[model samples]
Target: MSKRTAIIDIGSNSARLVIFEKTSRYGFHLICEQKSKVRIGEAAYEKEGYLQPIGIKRAYFTLKSFLHTIDKYQANKTLCIATSALRDAPNGKEFVQWIQKELGLSIKVIDGNKEAKYGGIAAVNLLPISEGISIDIGGGSSDMTLIKHGYIVDTYSLDLGTVRLKELFFDKGVNPSEINEKAKAYIQHELEKLPEHFRHTLAIGIGGTARTLSKGIMKQVAYPLDKLHAFTYNVSEHRSYLDAIPLSSAKNLKRFGLKKNRYDTIREGTLIFNEILSHIGTETVISSAAGVREGVYLEQLLKKDNLKFPSRINPSVTSILDRFQPLVNIQKNQKTKRKLASNLYTVLQQDINDNKQYEKELLWAVKLSSIGQTLTVYRSHQHAFYIAMQELNHGFTHEEILLISFLLRMNEKELLNKPLFTHYKPLLPEKSTLLWLSFIYTLTVLLQEASNNAGITFTYTNKTLRIISDKPLYLAKEKVKALEKPIPFAIIIEDESTLPKNKKLGI
Candidate 1:
């Protein structure tokens, strides 16, 4: 049976509730999410570091409504965590006690180090990054975690955040130049206290500030894809826009297509972010939509299994399969197709100049090729392409997703060309390489469906390729010939029984 869980993250800037439905052990999807800009840290920075009455009231109402959602979904578990705002406040613990007494809810207040650790965990487990520094800029504090070899190596939390900085300098109506100099000086001083070893070339940005910045950049560049999780940019390439943000007025910011509510703190957030990038000597920044909420859910799930992290499980693939598996019964066939496709790819590697970089994507295409059969057998390949493009949300770069979808959309004798190819040309591999992968996938599926056997083998030369199977090859041979028109080489299919018993086909 499936399970559902809810995680409530009450940060300095906003209170959010995310409900996740677990269709399988490690396969889950976001069912519903709610965010309220309660600004729980509003005026707390200037008000002697106490949880302000208005802020507390806003948080209370947000949580009360979130509880109604938990009851609606019947979430099996609920985790409420408070970050810098609550943890740094003088009356933070007092507020937690009151919430427990009045709202019947228990909130776990985590320190800075723990918050950094959770953010790091979310990045390493979800994003395709192994070595980088994750910067999560919250409303009250910024957390930095140094990750090496897929583990958190060091963590540092600075009292530099959007709300905090805005309260200290920007709200005073200081000129842009003075505000910039003062903020930079303070940021540099705090960052200098950390060890020099924390510097890295890649920086992963989390939290609202990072997400909003990525969206603004995407709009400026007219990026084709609307996805935000893996949106990336070169710091040097976009430095001009980053430099202009602090000086831009609210109207100017809105002209840049920023949300109205985000205008107040975006300037402060951008200044802090640009300073961090400069200090760390980072060249690239990848935006991550997952943060404290995802990290908290993962921590709880892993604890139940007594494991720290999943052992080589792709969360995106698992989640997709969990949702569509009941509609399709092709697991065994999918495995057979993948094996056969891999063997064929190996045999043709020499002729195709294979770099083996796309091997994983080819296998993914094989496993998901038949998913479209659930909807209808007519134009199933097109259906599969649509499903993959729209539904495969995590654990893949934009390029990989497009490549996989394009391969699934291939029909016999179709080669990638202009207009259609131009849309994703920047992210795609060479045309010849894509064609070879598409052919391999098509041939494998056709042969596997035609024959019932434990294994199939292949042999290839510059001019021709041969398929050797233990079973009769009459039907398989016909399909192979029909689909061989796009390939440069001819194909021959033969029964393995015709050969000597001592001979073995290359796999």
Candidate 2:
């Protein structure tokens, strides 16, 4: 049976509640989310770390509203966590007790190290990077985790959140240049205490600051895809844009397409991120939309299994299948198609170097190839392409999602030559590479559907490719021939009937 649970994370800058509907024992997806920028840490740092009455009231009402939402969803469990602000405040425990007595809600105020661990958990489980540094910049503190081989090796939480910095310096009407220098000095001081091994080439950014910066960059580049999670950029390539952010005025920030709600703290966030990149010597940053709240959900979900992370399960694909449950039978059609595609890819791989890394994506495409048929049988591939592009959210980079979508839509050669293909060319692999993979996918589908009680095998030589089937194959050769763009190799197909009666096919 499925279960509904809500995770509420009250940060120094904002309070957010995310409700996840468990689709299976190990699969779940975000069903509802809400956030309020209460700035709970506003002036608290300047005032001896006390929760201001106004901020307290704001957070109380936000939680009250969240309770209503939780009730509406019938969430059987709610995990409420407070980070930075509540944990650092002198009255933090008092406030927790007050909320428990008055609002009938239990709140756990986690320390910095635990906060950092949660951020790492979310990134390591969801994002593509297995070894990197994960950073979550909140309003009051910044959490950094060193991930090695999909596990957290070390964690550090710096008292350098955007809102915390804004309160310390920027809110005092200081010049942008002066604030930038002071913030940089402070950040350098904190980061210098960390061990050198924590500085990694790849940085997975989590929380609102990273998400907002990703949006601004996306707008600047006119990124075709609108998804925020897994959006990546090379730090060196975009250094100037990051540098210009602290000096950008509110009007300019708006012109740059930053969200209005984020305008107040974005400059501080950018400066902090700039300092972080400088300190770590990060090369590339992949933005993640999941953070502490998602991490909390994962904790609850994985507790019974005596595991901290799901083993080799792509949450994004599992969630998609759970929601759609495509008409294709998993044990029969989809599994067979995937097996054939894998076998063909293995044989074809001898001639290709760059396409080897695409094995995971190819498998995802084959698994979801028939999902569009649920929408409409006519032009189902097109529908499937749209669905994959728009809805396959987690565990994939934008390029991977786009490639899978294009591969799924490849029923004819014209689809590859369309204007849409050119528009997304930057995100796609080389045209020849795409054609090879798509051709393999097409052949798998056709061969899987063409004959029953038939086994397919592929053999390749320097200049020729041969396909052998254990049963008589009656597929239209023209369909296969159409995929031969410039014909990389000569092709031949044969059936078991053509072999001598005394001879047996090699396995």
Candidate 3:
């Protein structure tokens, strides 16, 4: 694979191009994304899967514009694939040949099963999910893949799609309730053929319809974070809202916060999604921003090492560190800092009333704590906070991202930012837990700054923290004295008697 790769996916409803730039052997990020609602499969379902001239013109112009972007980015490689629309069309091969001759671009028409597998690959690698059913409801077909233990187990695609249903029922001059009954019955008939083993507790939603619905749910519930990639909700809790989309009139979609552009097909998409969720016994729905484009890119990127990212490797983290970290290796003592932080967290668990649930997040914070220094030493915590919030995007839950960002924002004077904490309180752990994690993180940073390789030990008893070191820690002692504590705790530094035993250290 080249350093830069562009992936073009032509679905039934729209066409999209995403360019990914690799930062390292195993790290990559999307640099550019463009989409056009070509609706290439328009009127095709009604005409026995024949491509209409109107749809062809729209798709041709979209592809031509996409090529201009591909040139602008100088993408080293381009992978193009078409689903449902072309695969079902009788003259699909003729269109492919026409595009190739005119635009010098090759388009591979993938089967429904391959489409489902692509979505599954994307969900398994990008989202923090191990077992679930990946559902991608496109314009002309709904693709599904069963994932177990972080691998795709089986893939199935149904003829049921938003555009297909819309053309067959919603767009017809029939009664609204009649359309609903017919559409439901049609979706049920298609779902009846799904394997019984596809039923699962979790459902990963991919593609445009899922994203649009997730955005509405986020606004309705006043979700703090605006990110949609990992936004999750209980299927049972939102059943009413999910069921109401199909029932709502076109003129009334604005009340539900749906965009005007999606008015034509959202109802159809939601209806298909709801019926599928009901069929698969899904209790939870996790929205994913990645879909066929990402999966297609990753398929080539990780082909040598199987179709999954290596265990314990987070692409977002690695990409950020690779791009932002100083080449001089400013954080040479990172390993030592992690050790000290881990020790403090473990020893202070009883005092903070924690069960090591956030230990992984704390360690991630430690690794990225110094990255902000590359920008400027003054107010580096703020820089780090912003970077972690923006860059810790993939392979993490909303709660984990918020926690890691909060940990990176701590300073010596204050362990808690009350206003910021209040804003994200709904997604974060208890205030007391956060305060302790911040304190541990700040102290570890201070210790690492004072002595890169000091032999240090920690002990906590009777509301007192004892820091024992082999050599004098004059700077660490002074810094520790001024630091804020989550709870009322005294500090006794046994570092070559740097401080008097009677000195007060608790706040």
List lDDT for all candidates, in order.
0.83, 0.82, 0.90
**Which of 1 and 2 is ahead in lDDT?**
1
Worst 10 residues of 2 by lDDT: 478-487
Over 1-507, each residue of candidate 2 has an lDDT whose tens digit, in order, gives 239888899999999999999887667888899989888877899899999999999999999999999999999888899999999999988999999998999999998889988888888778877888888888988889999987889999888898888888777764777777887788889878777887888998898888988888899898877788899999988888888988776567777678998888999898888888778889999999888887777777776754354666777777777776565546577677788889888888777656577988888898887787777778888888888877787777888988898888877554375676888888988887887788777777767767674777889887677878778776645566665442467877777667666655654
Q: In model 1, what lDDT does residue 20 have?
A: 88
Note the residue pairs that clash in candidate 3: none
Tell me the spans in candidate 3 whose CA falls farther than 4 Å from its real position: 328-332, 496-507
Residue-level error in angstroms, candidate 1, position 136: 0.1
lDDT of 1 by residue, 1-507 (tens): 238889999999899999988877787789999999988989999888898989999999999999999999999888899999999899999999999998888999998888888898888877878889999999988899999988888999888889889988888864788888888888888888767887998999999888888998999988877778878899999899888998876567876667777998999999889988999999999889898888888777666644245665777778777765435346687778888888888988887777677989999988877777777888888888888888776667888888888887876545453565777777788877887888888887778767875457888876788888777666767667777344578888767656567766643
- lDDT, residue 199, candidate 1: 95
Tell me how far the alpha carbon of residue 228 in candidate 3 is from the true structure, in angstroms, after superposition.
0.6
The TM-score measured for candidate 2 stands at 0.90
Give the TM-scores of the predictions, in the order they appear: 0.92, 0.90, 0.96
The list of candidate 1 runs beyond 4 A from truth reads: 304-311, 326-332, 413-420, 473-478, 484-486, 495-507
lDDT of 3: 0.90
